[model samples]
Each structure stands twice: as C-alpha cells, then as structure tokens.
Target: MSNDTAAQPAYFIAHITVDDVEGYRNYEKGFFPVLKPSGARFVTYDDNVTVLEGERESGRTIMIEFPSEEALMTWWDSPEYRELAKVRQAAVTTHSVTIVHSLPPR
Candidate 1:
C-alpha cells in the first residue's frame, strides 16, 4: 500500500483440481506465511464447489482479497510465493486464477 494511494480492492479467484494429495498438503503448510506478508487476506476455500454456469473444472475453489491490485500482484509475483508455488504446481491442475478489481468508490 503506497502512500500516494489511488488503489481499489482486489480479489483473486482460483479453481483447481488436486493431482497429488500429499503435495498439496505440503503446499498448504507453506502457503500462509508467504501470503500474509503482502496484506492479502484469504476469503474462502470451497471443496464442494458448485459451478452454476459455463464449462469449468470443479474441484476446489479459493478466493483471496487484497487491499489493492498492486498488493495482490506483489504477492503473486514475489520470489517467496514463486518458490513455494513449485509445491502447488506439482500438486494440482489450475483451472483459473482470475483477478477481479473492485469498482471505484463513489
């Protein structure tokens, strides 16, 4: 969060199918510490995900909220997360990772 702020909130949505259970557990063990530093907050984790529309893989859903899009990107592109992601990369098949920005305040 920069001082000269013109930032809007952001949400990260991810849909994934676990490929290796043990690997995913390992990934989870290392996930939070890396995530917290960026000021992003976990919103939800759904195992019984219901897809109401369109064609998309349905297994697990994860949502994270950030103070700003920049903060989300910073965490996403950080070396720590990148390195930790190797575990997650090997653990699951990611269907989507969407970034939704909040509408500007009126």
Candidate 2:
C-alpha cells in the first residue's frame, strides 16, 4: 500500500515484561489464530535483549512484519485481538507498542 514512504512495509514492535506466565500463555494460545488472517509474519522474540544506547522499558521484545500498515492495523484493531489483548494486559507490563515503516523501495 502507498503512504508517505510510497509503499514501505510495516512492522510492529512489542516491548513486554511478562508478569504472569499463565496469563501470557492464555494470550499466546490465541495469538496465531487471530494473526493468521492478516498475513502478518512473526519475526522473532528475544528474552535476552540488550540496550546499546538509550534505556528501554522491558527485556522481552517481539516483532512482526506486515505487508502494509493497513493490514497490520486491521488485525490489531479487530475485536478478537482487542479481547485477547486484555489477557496480555493482565499478564505483562507492556513498555511500548510501536509501528514502524521500512524505507521506501530503493
């Protein structure tokens, strides 16, 4: 999809500090089913994260790549995800959730 960057890909970043394993598991159990329809790609998650520069809020990092910002938002804003997010909210301290766009095609 076109944007100010003219068709740049979008990525979602989640900085989370999980508090209740069972609660996060509850959220994780349903994550893929909701994520599947959006065509979002799970990049990876890092539990051993290091901050090279500025300080960060959490130690766990999760990333997902999407074809476009619209696709990412569509999945993120859906009722299923909204409901599931509550489970995550109860389980973790989410430092930040950010959407970033890649550089436009070179």
What residue runs in model 2 are displaced by over 4 Å at the alpha carbon? Answer: 1-7
lDDT of 1 by residue, 5-82 (tens): 437878999989999999999999999999999888899999886668867675799999998888998999999999
Query: Whole-model lDDT, candidate 2?
Result: 0.88
Worst 10 residues of 2 by lDDT: 1-10
Give the Å shift of residue 48 in candidate 1.
1.7
TM-score of each: 0.89, 0.89
Error of 2 at 62 (Å): 0.3
Provide the lDDT at 5 for model 1: 43
Instruction: Give the per-residue lDDT of model 2 (tens digit) for 1-106.
Output: 4465534569999999999999999999999999999988999999988789988775699999997888888999999999999999999999999999887766
